[model samples]
Target: MQLTIERIYTKTVDHDGYRILVDRHWPRGISKVNAALDDWAKAIAPTTELRQWFNHIKDRFPEFQTRYLQELEQNPETPAFVTEVAKQLQTTNVILLYGAKDQEHNQAVVLLQYLQRQPAIQALLRKE
Candidate 1:
């Protein structure tokens, strides 16, 4: 299933079946009620070390992906969880909400890329 990015401040979509947050740290100003997220996949977010290392640096993307993938591979639950989230997208659009100011380079983007690469995930997304 395709993963779309959305800002936390934006209105929640009625068709958005499952709104999943892919950020490690919660947004500074938003409250839980305002988030409107169905699932907070914090477990899949990058480790503190990786988060600190990347820090949204554009040139460090190659290094970031390498380290992020390492984290994903080690976390057995992440792949399955992401695959399931992809499946959920089939029935309803999954809004991958994130709080990062730099939209281009963020954990959500990396997480979205990994989810889209799954064969089963693509199939599920295609049906929708």
Candidate 2:
């Protein structure tokens, strides 16, 4: 699947295939209409408890990534969500949008990596 991650604040464009806000909460200052989102995969995001514990601290990112991955593995919706994203990528680019200012240290980054590591997704990528 062709997947990418970007800040939700970035300007929308025609080429942002299936824009999905991967955040658990709506970003501040962005209107729903302006988001131009095809989906808001809140169920797949980190749990509120986990989010509060990490608090976006840079030093906590590694631990956060591990914890988030565990969360994803345990989350009942993740498999279905991943399948849906893969299906969408067959025809369009799937952008995983997030609100975090630190691009390298957000949940979206971890999620993207997790998606890429999946054998099914990797096979899909090889086909394209």
Top of the candidates by lDDT: 2
lDDT of 2 by residue, 59-125 (tens): 9999999999999999999999889888888888889999999989999999999999877677778
For candidate 2, give the lDDT of residue 104: 93
Query: Which residue pairs of candidate 2 clash?
Result: none
C-alpha RMSD by candidate, in order: 2.1, 1.3
lDDT of 1 by residue, 1-128 (tens): 34577767666543346888888789888898778778888888899999998988889988998899889989977867867686687677777888888777887777778877878777776775
Error of 2 at 66 (Å): 0.5
Q: In candidate 2, residue 2 scores what lDDT?
A: 72
lDDT of 1: 0.79
